[model samples]
Target: RRRGGGGGVETAADFARTAPRAGYLHKLGTNVRQYKRRFFVLRPSTHLYYFLGPNDAEPRGCIELDGGGVSAVRELETMPDGRFRFEISLGGDGGEGDAGGMDASFASANDDGGGGRDGGGPRRIVLEARSAECGREWIDSLRSESLPYVRAELESSRSEADELRARCAALEARVEEMRLVERDRDGAV
Candidate 1:
């Protein structure tokens, strides 16, 4: 398992070509609860990946911002040292613990000194940014990227609501027909 500084150094052009948001952030370890600096890259696909370093060929872990993988992203109160932080709450059925779909060795490495699972069910990952402005920018970028998933969900809900409304209308029409039949029967009697 690679530590913080094993990968190649990233150039400005690399950042420009790869992702809009790519930088170093201190991630709170799940088991140790200690903060470790990791290089994160937020992709256009709504996947936030953290590497041991900027040039790692494969990501140590990935957090899917769309598809119910992420529940929320919110800024946290500043630390006593004045560090701006944010939390990413993973959805219930999201990645495996704090490893975020990492392999066993990678997860174990993180568990020992890096990061790990907090507990059962949905979990949250806290990341500290270099500054308040940077923190807010990261949050905004994450929220914006995840909007597609939210829009898709909204579309689904609207379709369901339309179906329910149609069902209700049909039921009301059936009730009105039954009432008419009852009135005719009473007149005939």
Candidate 2:
């Protein structure tokens, strides 16, 4: 029978298989538009962790990798119009929100075609990858690692919504009952 997640029995263990699901996706800053080779790791349920190097135990910074925050990870086929080096962008996924429609899922780092498809979400982050291969690996790893958390967050959101609906229904019933009592008192007076 299914456990925690109904029918399928998806669990935390499923998301937390092993550490360092993949290597770093490299790093880039748009302000200066520079590249930095930093090692990265993801906890799937929590953070997209980056360390100064692979050997470092602590993270440099953790990007919120959940659905409520970052959206999708895609490596641009080629550099966006102007600039040097390849890039991988995270967020929105161009409103596709699905495997078929998303360009990031298909495009290769060095191939060449449009930039990222992140729509206009403020959270979107684009970073430089040294080569096409590096961008591909980062996209694959980020896409795979982030999906489970998104599903879980969606499931949680749905449950909360249902509960809120129930509460609203109960409040409505109570308000109607009070109104009826008020009418009865008016009539008696």
Candidate 3:
């Protein structure tokens, strides 16, 4: 009998053995680390993760299913004409949940001519942006401008706060010393 109710007991391995219940075309990928709170799925094959918003000048990275869970490790790049190319590998035997079906998952990543069908077929997704600066160029801007600006502001504030704290500590110590002197004088009287 099934441990829960409807069927028999199933181990984690059993769930892993099962195939995807249904095929999902053009599933986007997202990460809380690189893309912040934004969640977007790129083409399935490429699994490209494009960060959207007025501030997002370029797409971030991609996510791949290592096994049961997803991993955001590889990075995706765009071509001269705004097209993207994602190349990753699936380790071990090419089985049910292997990366073979990734082509259909990211179908939007392909061109209209369908000429760039690698070995399997066109990627299942493309994850186009409503508005985006050039790909890598935009990322460089973030590093050169936004991040540096934030860091500098934080450092300056921290230094000021630290100096204030030190001054307060010194004043407190002086007050305690005066209190002891007053106590000694009173005791003598």
lDDT value for model 3: 0.35
Q: Candidate 1, TM-score vs. the true structure?
A: 0.60
**Residue by residue across 17-97, what tens digits does model 1's lDDT show?**
568688888888766778888788877645777766766645566676766678878998787777898888877565422
lDDT by residue (1-189, candidate 3, tens digit) is 123554654332232233221111122332211212233333322222323322332322233332312211233665466543332333332211222243344323311211122476323222222223433332232222333344677899999999999999999999999999999999999
lDDT of each: 0.70, 0.51, 0.35
* Each prediction's RMSD to truth: 9.9, 15.1, 14.9
The runs of at least 3 residues in candidate 2 whose Cα sits more than 4 Å from the true structure, single-residue gaps closed, are 1-17, 79-121, 147-189
lDDT of 2 by residue, 36-71 (tens): 655655565545655565544334445545544455
lDDT head-to-head 1 vs 3, winner = 1
Off by over 4 Å in 1: 1-16, 96-121, 147-189
Q: After superposition, how far is residue 85 of candidate 2 from its true place, in Å?
A: 6.9
Output the lDDT of residue 80, model 2. 62
